[model samples]
Target: MSIRSVITTADEQVPFAAVKERIVQAMCAAGLGAVLLFGAGFSSMETLHNAAHDSRHSAGFPCH
Candidate 1:
């Protein structure tokens, strides 16, 4: 198959609306993750704090 045909076929597999929806979903997921991160920081529960602390260290966030 020619390069143009290959490109066109790949492009048709995902519609613009589908791409936009995926972007929106990704943004919403990220927002929720940020909220959870903030909530974990303020949580009074020791388990939550310890889990978040360990995860931060694993992710190289430099939390003491």
Candidate 2:
């Protein structure tokens, strides 16, 4: 393909690329949140469990 045509095609896909990047970032954030909120919150380690518990209480997220 011509250089201009290639550039045009790439430009047209910019929005899709942005949307895909956003989705990936959101998924990663969700996974991390789950690990911190559930995994660490319920951990056997007292420190981790307490920290998550305190965070939830501070955020007004009911734990009981």
Candidate 3:
């Protein structure tokens, strides 16, 4: 491929690459949120429960 064509192709792919990156980031964030919300929120360990509770309280999430 010519240099100009290669540059054009790369430019065309920029938007697609950015969109894919955003989707992956969003999915990872959601997965992490689920783990923290359910896994830590309902843990049998007192330390985990207290940590989550304190974090929620600090964030003003109203756990009560």
Candidate 4:
């Protein structure tokens, strides 16, 4: 018995609609999360502020 690999036969076009749907979903989720965090709905004031502050420092963003 021989094993074979299935490769694209050049008949398939890029699935643009599917790609766009996934991209839009991801962006929406990120936007919702950002609103929750920045709007102080995700946690208390101190926790949110400290988390943002620490992340900024770690990422080398000016937070001073």
Question: Of the candidates shown, which would achieve the greatest lDDT relative to the real structure?
Answer: 1
Which residue pairs clash within candidate 2? none
- Per-residue lDDT tens digits for candidate 3, residues 1-64, read 7888656654355678888999999999999999988986677798887887999999999998
Look at candidate 2 and tell me the lDDT of residue 64.
88
Q: Report the lDDT of model 2 for residue 17.
A: 80
Model 4 TM-score?
A: 0.43
Kindly give the stretch of ten consecutive residues in candidate 3 with the minimal lDDT sum: 5-14
Candidate 1 lDDT score at position 43: 83
Candidate 4 colliding pairs, count = 0
Q: What is the TM-score of each candidate against the true structure?
A: 0.49, 0.47, 0.49, 0.43
Q: Whole-model Cα lDDT per candidate?
A: 0.86, 0.84, 0.84, 0.83
| lDDT (Cα, tens digit) per residue for candidate 1, span 26-58 | 999999999988987778799787887999999
Worst 10 residues of 4 by lDDT: 1-10
What value does the lDDT take at residue 2 in candidate 3? 81
Pairs that clash in candidate 4: none
* Candidate 2 lDDT by residue in tens digits, 1-64: 7888656554365678889999999999999999878976566788877887999999999998
